[model samples]
Target: MSVDRSYIRVKAMLVSPNDDGSRHLVSRNAPTSENPLGFHRLIGGSVELGETHQEAIIREVHEELGARILDLTHLGMVESIFRYNGELGHEIVALYSGRLEPAPADEGGTLTESDGSVVPVVWRPFDDADITVPLYPAGARNWIRSSLT
Candidate 1:
């Protein structure tokens, strides 16, 4: 199905922490015209028409990483308005906190997208360097910090 880029999209995302909660799982995003350096984002995807945000998160995690989420909790919501690949995109993201079952390797790994493209997944410290590629949706880091605390 072709997405209507002109309309705001709704997504459900999961912020899954490691065993010690020192780092979280994120997938590396490819460099777009708006982000030449690329970035990292939480795991999850769009909420299907009949599915709840919670259901969407679980389904997305399973699809992307072949894992299940435990202790799922609604964190908060974030509105993301940004440009990607030269196109302006808007989204209302529902953020959820949880743990991944059979957690990803400590050293990091890769996730295969629905489109058949593979992207690296890594455990990144919360306070990574400011100069490094940023986490998308701007205030996502803040929500993650609050959920962990």
Candidate 2:
């Protein structure tokens, strides 16, 4: 059985600075994390019924990590046609670059799902966070490499 979901979403890739001023990205580890395991996801979800892209991003960050997102500078958008969890999925993703305000670090933030699973909010090293990983999207990867110079 192949499940199909076609929708639009907003992604907030938070650039958090280390004590030395180098930046790292915050992400969520996928439930099905495997192989290389333990990577943060692009922080966003479905745009919801009537929310604007910006609103959606903020809401997603808050819900997922309980952190208030700020300075959401729009990156770009992509038409992603891909397969997810053995299913076909398509998403129009609007990207944003920003930081978390009063954001938890040192492995502080976490999400408790309805099933009582704890999802860790990870601060992924910048170099390690690329398209080669399972979570980072190709579109954002290209934009990050080309535009964020």
Candidate 3:
């Protein structure tokens, strides 16, 4: 079994407006069949050898959420070690918090769920993040908390 010695990853904040000063988070579900790392909550993926972290995040946001990223700012890096179904990998995930362009309407781009099925974009109240269905990565919560402040 070959393993990737090193890899870079990115995650988008995907923020929307709320009546209050706080913002809502646009999240999705990871396709359980295709992705085991719970990657659905944020729009991101691995950065290729020649691709920059920002490029990858922007590309993924368009691909997954079907919305253009107006702004993407780095939220520092988090050391993530993931073990899925016996496969182990480590990532230097560059977390980012950004606002979506066009102010996500009721309908958004096609995003895959944990079962490898497509799910529509969802607007989640930041305060009620915990009760939402489908689990998210620890780094995502951390970034949101820090970014909002």
Output the number of the TM-score-best candidate: 1
How high is the lDDT of residue 13 in model 2?
A: 42
Candidate lDDT scores, in order, read 0.85, 0.59, 0.57
lDDT of 1 by residue, 37-121 (tens): 8988888889989999888998899998999988999988999998777778899999998999989998758887777788899
Candidate rank order under lDDT? 1, 2, 3
Say which candidate scores most in lDDT: 1
Query: How high is the lDDT of residue 107 in model 3?
Result: 48
Q: What tens digits encode model 2's per-residue C-alpha lDDT throughout 40-98?
A: 55666667677788887778777766777666688778666655555566677887767
The 10 consecutive residues of candidate 2 with the worst lDDT sum are 1-10
lDDT by residue (tens digit), candidate 3, 71-95 = 5677777666665445555666667
- How displaced is residue 121 in candidate 1, in Å? 0.5
TM-score of each: 0.92, 0.71, 0.64
List residue ranges in candidate 2 displaced over 4 A.
1-21, 31-39, 112-117, 129-132
Q: List the residue pairs that clash in candidate 2.
A: 27-40, 28-40, 28-41
TM-score ranking from best to worst? 1, 2, 3
